[model samples]
Target chain A: MTVYSNCHVITFNYRQSGIMERIYLDNNATTIVDPAVRDTMEPFYCHMYGNPNSLHLFGIEVRPYLHQAMEQLYSGIGASDADDIIINSCATEGNNTVILGFYFNLLKDTRKKHIITTQLEHPCVRESCRFLERHGVKVTYLAPDRDGLITAKMVKDAITDQTALVSVMWANNETGIILPIEEISKVCKEQGVYLHSDAVQAIGKVKVDLQKVRVDFLTFSAHKFHGPKGVGGLYIRDGLNLPPLLHGGEQMGGHRAGTVNVAGTVAMGKAIELANASLDFENREVRRLRDKLEDALLKNADVLVVGKRELRTPNTLYVSIRGVEGESMIWDLNQNGIAASTGSACASESLEASPILTAIGADRELAHTGVRFSLSRFTTEKEIDITIEVANKAIERLRQLSTSY
Target chain B: MAKSDLIGGELWEQYSQRVADRMNNPRNFGELTESDAQKLGGRLVIADEGAESCGDTVRLFWIVDEKTNIIKKATFKSFGCGTAIAATDMMAEMCIGRTVDEAAKITNLEVEHALRDQEDVAAVPPQKMHCSVMAYEVIKRATSIYRNVDISTLAETDIVCECARVSLQTIEDAIRINDLKTVQEITDYTKAGAFCKSCIQPGGHEKRDIYIVDILARVRAEIERERNPHRTLSAEFAKLSVIKQFKAIESVLDEHIRPVLARDGGGIELEDIQPGENGIINVHIRYQGSCKGCAGNVAGTLSFVEQTLQKNLSENIRGVVV
Candidate 1:
């Protein structure tokens, strides 16, 4: 493995003969697995390969590591020992489980058969609500305000007696605008409704103290926070008694049934530990780099940043250049060894205007032009400088060719 | 930095070198000013078209030499993706020395082909194919402006698939040129019925004036007739008995007409068939379901049924609503 002192600058093996310097700014999509996390996971793969459920001495040796990892996970989010965090696949699975589990466990035959989610949610939550809608569940998709904010009052006004649960994302994946989850959680508690927050984008980037904010359920994926992909955690508030989404073995206390991904769980523990330690770096240096890039982009007359910087996750900068389409900008950036995104990578394949941008009342033309540049703790000032220069040149060339002017 | 050292990986290789070059530094970018046209002793024609799906717009500017009806210069401006820039730049270059009429004949396929570095490799991906189509559309728009005619008269063909901008003439030409057989083949070659599929056949999500299934059948029949040279449609229909003719007309109505009307909560039923004066065969029909007593049954629906029967069965057959 090649190591660079500056973690952001890496030599990527291009399809052609030579190597190219790769600068990653799409960390909100996924992050590179931290070296420490990788080192922690190495032993679990071959050496400590016993199933956590086995009764042999091999399983007995692995119990303490699993217990320590569990403690690390609970402490990362400030969840008390009373609550349960079921390790599962990515946050997409966790989101589906929570949203669907509510319907099957509590809301299916009840008079309260309604779900409330925002229009700006990740597709997992939005699609899960859509799946329930086919089964006679009435879903009210609340639209965000012009500033891309979903207020506590919006949730308060939208809740009906027939509302079974309110599922809101802690931070929007595209815009990175942090929602009022605390106030929304209080409202859900007051109304006696179950609340689930898909905190996949918020866990490592922002402060997520469950002791401070009382939410019934929260879900996060490890990949978004510099851990290996595939493994995620779903926090169930104590005594909730929700039925399992997968129904075979008696793993995760019969809440989730597959054999635990020991390596992935261990890596996730180290990733979260590193994330907590680097929270200050994320808020200061990463935010500074993101702001520097945003300032450079804002020098252009037609660039529109999605949300105010203060309200968004410090590492994120979502901007729309008036004339340049998102994919075109991404293409130009890719050619220059810079990595960025046009909203969620999952939905970018459809080439449709971003639903999050549209939900925030951006015009159709502006919505198609949104490019998100997300920073990570490893991103350096030199990478930011190079990105600013390359992005400026791309925007200028694309604008010169644009008919919008 | 070396050009080959770009970090796009496979996606960079997907685009032709010419496309990559033009996309990065388009030669025919920006519009020609009125003074620029005057210096060339020509008139300026500007036309723009927008893709509603992706919000990409392309505008073409041409300086036409009025005396010879030739294009003195052509340039373009695109508010779209990179492929749109490359496609429009290549289109503009192709139009520079040609006459306005000659430039109007330029197809999206030619523009797409002109950008390819290799013989058979596609210049752009399938999703970006519409960018080249957009370039072709702006040319028609510019031609219409230069000729002072309506844009619709320029193509002289119905747009069969609006999503992909595949015209009936384009589809028919593709079928003839490429020897395309099935609708799937047409979609693969020309991208008609590839998206939304409203124009593939009747009873789709949206109503279409003309369908690809009908075009395929008509063009295939034309090809068949050209090959055989002896089996004439009129002679074949003339040999059928009146009952056979009625059944043929009924089947044509069932296949072509009923499904479209059914979607609108209406239906049609054949009443009778009679030999009118000369070679004319008059087929009587009645409206059913929501179509009964509807004013459209006499006007639009009557002509539609007559046209369907005439096209499928025999040109001598006419429809009279009872």
Candidate 2:
């Protein structure tokens, strides 16, 4: 006889899989793990499951794979040296490491207690600054213009003698607005300040050459480009002595300390190799499909494509339909078996409007009405067409029912 | 082959087929015609409700038989997600054949129940559960309109936790009568804040009119005030540093002012603080969201902010619109 304590449980329908017709357009939230990446990771799970630090042949054999993954990732992102790459968890951990690293490193220095960042950063970076702000650090959040572009002049104007670091993203996760990192780097270099970019959304979609940009630090996650989850990389320029966030036995040259995620690195290596090979396709075919979807939706519905005037990632299309809300639009699209997202997935649950949308000077109603349809190499023309149709119908219905409309 | 089968199709298992069916062909859709309304004794009422978070709205139309005081027909137009449509459609269907008074008694839970094919399985996803609430509110407005009464005064009980159907009076009585201290105890007693947890704090999955923590704190403060009526609320708030003072004011605003502003798609942000005349602290704030450029900012809302701050924070503190 089975005895239970309480009967309170939330259960789902548990329908059979491989039976529904659904379109997944929310790629920025997380991409599906590539089959090639999965195949590359499968062998390590059983046969070659060895700790990279061990003295045996199993360890030595896996060590080469880890290095190869790092080499592939660094080369793909245009990092000059292999030692600069420090593998960690997702971009959240990488961002926290850089922020806390700088915050803790600058604790002794009385004069340099200031940090400059934009209002368009991911919550990981923005919340980290807020955490520092609560602990007596002065943070100046530079707001963006209407098009969601943060000028290098904005960064230059905000930087002062007391400023220790300037952290910004290469591309926004929500609006896909690309920042002028090279120009921002030039200003930071002139001001003698360290600059960090959360390049998670930019890694697979755009070309980021650190040699050309001259930024001190950059970060990217593996899963954004069809790799497995739980693995990311950070690049620190030479001679930057920032403290480590994690403390343990030597790992990644003591920059990030944890037992090696060998399988993750192997999958990431394969994923990045594929992503680099398909960069041209992403810039062309993926972009064309994204444009087609946006154009179709704009023609049929009254919606504003966010950051249309600025440089944006090829795979992202952020739109704000008049008289309808983002959550409802996404939900209606989901009913038609389409997957889209509103703002960042972490903050999606909360009813608060997207802070990024607000930061870009969107009116309150428009900020609450935006939906993001992020694509990947896996997204097809057929899916885009269906999404446009479903989205238009959903919007039309919602507008008819809406009090605002 | 179905189009989505090309992709793995594993995640679609979350929602039941009944939800898909209801979403595709919603029941009780569209509106009652003028002739149809005339046939029902010209007792027609139309009510529109909106969700601020997503800007989704629903317009409910009800045709009541004036002589019998019974609803002859009900229909709706929804500008929202599938859940809102299905919930509103089901609510309209539930309204038919019942008197306006009886139809007004139908709750959002009953609307949700009508949409679900199974008891355990939800008709809509948990996050979309609030969509059904729009349907429930529109019904109240429709009923009140048909009866020529105020909408706010219709809901006899003060509902606090919508998901659990717990009322404000029930929660207040639970705390005061049972001598409760913790939010968990209140949940165990009345099941308020048990389901969605939005009624418990500021940053929950859903927004609520009143929170359990606030209710508990107010009740506790009232009890304290009864014990010693001389002690002032937020007396030391003025003595804190500018940022700390901002933080305290921000909490008060988040707890009180922001919710009221956010309801109308408006918001407020603290811009600065400077010394005013004769030891008064002047807090400069900029209106955001719908509040920006609103004509009411000068005469109407500014007074609400000033009065609320003066009554709560301190007499010397003043709110200055920037």
Candidate 3:
């Protein structure tokens, strides 16, 4: 009877999944696991469940697949075979490891006790810098310009002889503004300081070639590109040694120590391969849909889009619809079976305005009204059309209700 | 996908059915024009209030019958979150068909309760409770405009919780009527200390001489003394020497009042104390620091000082600002 009930539930969900027309535009938060990635990861769960550290035949069979996944990860980020790619749990963990590793390994012994990062960093990087500050490290948080660009000159001006590292994000998660990381990396190289870029938003949507961009450390997550959650990669350049964040078994050459997540690593490998293959489609098709949605939203005079279309990633649209609160707009969108976000999902519950918008010099009122709609390659034109219609209706109704009008 | 699928499963459950329904379709939305008011044989009263904490605002429209003093029609427009819209919708609905005096008596708790799916269940989450308080405030503004009086004249007692409009009299009445003991019970009944929570105790975002903690202690002590009728502390203040009386009053001001004023860069200094007719003790105070030239020193702050002194040291003490 239990098996029968389980089958009934599965059949019910399958039928509902095919018929429901839910529109998802919050891809920057996370993405659905692709069917191809899921298929590639299925065998490691039960059939080939062997600990990669064992010397038995069962473990020997898993070695080639693990090596292949590692190779895929190395090639995906354009890292050479000599460079080390440490697979860990998500970009947040990777970011913490790199920032804290600089303090624990290099800066602790040297006279250089300062680090420079931008105000536009993810909370993980920002809070990690703050944590280091409590431990007697001087940190400079450079603010972005009105265009939401953190220039290379800002990094050069903030750099000093005591500067040990410079960290910046490749693309902002809120405004979709890509920072000038190439020039910043060049400046860091000239200043004899290590450079790290949180390329979580740039890896799948844009072309990120580590060969051309000489960043010392780069981090990315597979889930941002349609892989499973709880798995990501951190790239360390050749001839650089940072102490391990997690200490236990000798895994990933002791750079990061843990039993390998075989299924998640395989899924990430497959997802990155697919993401690389779909780069052209992402630029052409996803960009077109995002532009269409932006054009539709711009028809209203009260709407203000955050960044220029030519400057941002192809999939993100962050806008502030005046006289409508972000949470209220998201509530209306969710009622219509459409998903969106405001600033960050983690900070949405607080009544405080978006810190990102405030950092970009937006007024307090405009900062309270930011709504983000991030697209994926799977987002259809019909979904965009429905979203446009629903969003317009919500704006009109909410504006009529607003006394400011 | 279901609504739970769009929002997370846990957050989706926070919205009650009635709140969601009213947010989607607010029945009492939009304003009444002057011609519409004239058509209903009443005068239009428009009142708007804004919440500085979240930049949410609500504007209320009422057409009061001149002779009968009844609200002929009521509507509102809210520039806020979904919970604000639902709260203002219910607040405006409760005003219609009731006299202006009766409508003015409506509280945020009543508006919040009217939006609930069940009797005991809350309509909105705790963080959104301030939206209903905004709704209740706009009604007071509209009432004051219709009656041609100041909004402050409508409240008979001091405000204990500025965020939720829970006054000292309202909280005391709620505690006495409902037999409330805990601070959570006071919040659940009167919505005091629900938002910001600076009024709950000292060392919060703001300071208050008469915190909910102090009020609970005073009320419980009064209840205990009432049961034991022979016990009294009223004559203790009159029996003290002049120097001891001055020290006693200074100590009470130091412990209870100075911290609240000092938090906002203001303070009060005791100028003099003298005996007045009818057994009254006149305590003269001069504003120091940021309190000088401030308008609240004449009204709210002065009364709060007197009330704190009366509750703590003696009931015969009166505060005089010099």
DockQ of each: 0.21, 0.15, 0.19
lDDT of 2 by residue, B105-199 (tens): 89988877776666766655444566577788888888777777888788756688876688888998998899999999999999787655678
Each model's C-alpha lDDT? 0.84, 0.79, 0.84
Model 3 off-target regions past 4 Å? Answer: A1-20, A107-110, A344-347, B1-9, B155-322
Q: Tell me which of candidates 1 and 3 scores higher on DockQ.
A: 1
Query: How many clashing pairs per prediction, in order?
Result: 0, 5, 0
Question: What pairs collide in candidate 1?
Answer: none
Show model 1 residue runs off by greater than 4 Å: A1-20, A344-347, B1-13, B162-191, B195-322
Candidate 2: tens digits of C-alpha lDDT, residues A189-305: 999999999999988888888878888888889999999899988888887866788899798888888998989988988898899888899999999999999888889556788
DockQ of 1: 0.21
Candidate 1 lDDT by residue in tens digits, B1-322: 3554354233344667778778767899887999999899999999988766557789999999999999999999998777778888999999999999999998877988898766777676554565576888899999999899998898746888855778788999999999889999999999898755667898754567999999999999899877853445555776799788878877887899999999999999889988888778889998999899898888898999888877666777788988
DockQ metric, candidate 3: 0.19
Clashing pairs in 3: none
Across A67-118, the per-residue lDDT of candidate 3 in tens digits comes to 8898788888899989988999989989999999999987788889999998
- Taking every candidate in turn, the Cα RMSD to the unseen true structure, in Å, is 11.6, 15.9, 12.6
Error of 1 at A228 (Å): 0.8
The CA lDDT at A254 in model 1 is 96
